[model samples]
Target chain A: MSFSLKKDKQGVVVVGVDGQLIVGNRQELKQKVLDTLESGGRKFVIDFTKTGYIDSSGLGVLVSLSKKIREQGGDLRLCGLNEDLQTLFELTKLDTLFAIARTPEEALAAF
Target chain B: MTQPQPPQPPQPLHVRRRATGGDTELSLDVPSDLDYVGRAVELIADQLPGGPLSPRRIRFNFRTAFAEALANAIAYGNHRDPGRVVHVRVEVAHDAVRVHVTDEGNGFDPKGVPDPTLPERLEREDGRGLFVLKSLMDQVAFNEKGNSVCLTLRAG
Candidate 1:
């Protein structure tokens, strides 16, 4: 429902989501990331520490964004997924396609 | 002698509860708008807390699956037509909860929906809703029309 964006010392863009990501607000998140990608911001991290739920639409946007970023020679990482979210990613088999980190620092370091 | 009662018009949202068995039923008729999907799921899922289902199960599994069903009904089923209404009915019993989501649009065959998990289809943005809801719910069933779906979650 809410998002926070900051640049780390290593120039990685860290975006934090603070609520459920469903069809209602997925476009906003997608556009924000797309806009960032267009602005030459490459390395990215989405923090889900405060996020409680995400539907298929939310996952779709993440996939779309990740593909776009990768196609443009950039990379995106995700961190701070709760147990439920981890299971969701596994259930959808997206865990194999995404680079997941345990923390924002880990994501930033990986990039 | 019993008197005949007048027919009542449908409301946007209606809730009925049975006092004897602690059973609750909620029905919602909302325009096919994505904005109403999250709130509707919240309202329905709120009824399950402190009951037979655990908080984690209700929070993640039920909420996620229910939200997907509503989104599918509003967006894909009704094609986001404001004139068309999406009907949702939720019944919560002592041991389980069942939800029915029906849309105004023509139905499709669930069998035709391809696997999103296949290696060839990983990057597709859509088509994952059905898979996610089915994975989260204990049982998923579709009517012959396919425009209506029933999702059931049982307490352990």
Candidate 2:
């Protein structure tokens, strides 16, 4: 799957993932994140509005992405997830691992 | 000359077929490759009847559950061997949908799968597929050989 990266005036990157976040293209997501980091991005917000489904492989990518961002002294925010996705995060207790915002504006503000 | 067996009734274009009480059924032999996974999901979605069950919810739940099961079949079951195949069957009724995913690989005990929701296992990624399937699907059953699994989902 592909993701769109939007940078606000303060340089916070809001990455919106499109289509299913499945194993077939999960690496594309990691590559995009790494690319963002290389470009001096620190504050990050991943919007899941377009992503309807995510499996364990996708979750792994997010967990690892969160850790990588934190290791670089950066913050990661997640927002706009549908209820099912929200439940997934809760079930896996991943909600405790990252800053979750209900909207992109709020996620950006969190940074 | 042996009388040609009266045109062996046109094989319903499916490898495995069955009829279940009041439910519509469809079956196909899907290639082990991941590319066909989307088609499998769509086949299940097409069987769902439009009603009070939120379309979005149905799509998400069925898609996630079906995808997880198919992924397991492809990865763990067939070992990603393109030469192998996965047999998928689906039954949809007014209130519920039933699916069976049979893979060719050596079966493993479903009970042996650890709970990914456990605190210590939160970061581990490999085991969560089954957990997600169990959580989203109404019921997840494994065959005695472990090479097959049945997932059922019902409208709320």
- The most accurate candidate by lDDT is 1
Model 1, position A90: C-alpha lDDT score: 96
Off by over 4 Å in 1: B1-20
lDDT of each residue in A11-101, candidate 2, tens digit only: 9988898877777677888899989998899989999988888877788888888888998999899999988899988987889877899
lDDT of 1 by residue, B1-156 (tens): 889988754335544444445877777787788988777877777655367678888888888998999999898899998789988888777898888999999988999999999989998998899999889999999999989999999975
DockQ for each numbered candidate: 0.68, 0.40
Q: lDDT tens digits, residues A83-106, model 1? A: 999999998999998999988878
Clash pairs, candidate 1, are none
Per-candidate TM-score against the hidden true structure: 0.91, 0.86
Each prediction's fraction of true contacts recovered: 0.88, 0.49
Q: Report the lDDT tens digits of candidate 2 across residue range B29-100.
A: 877776667656766566555642468766788888888888889999998897998888877667877789
The docking category that best describes candidate 2 is acceptable
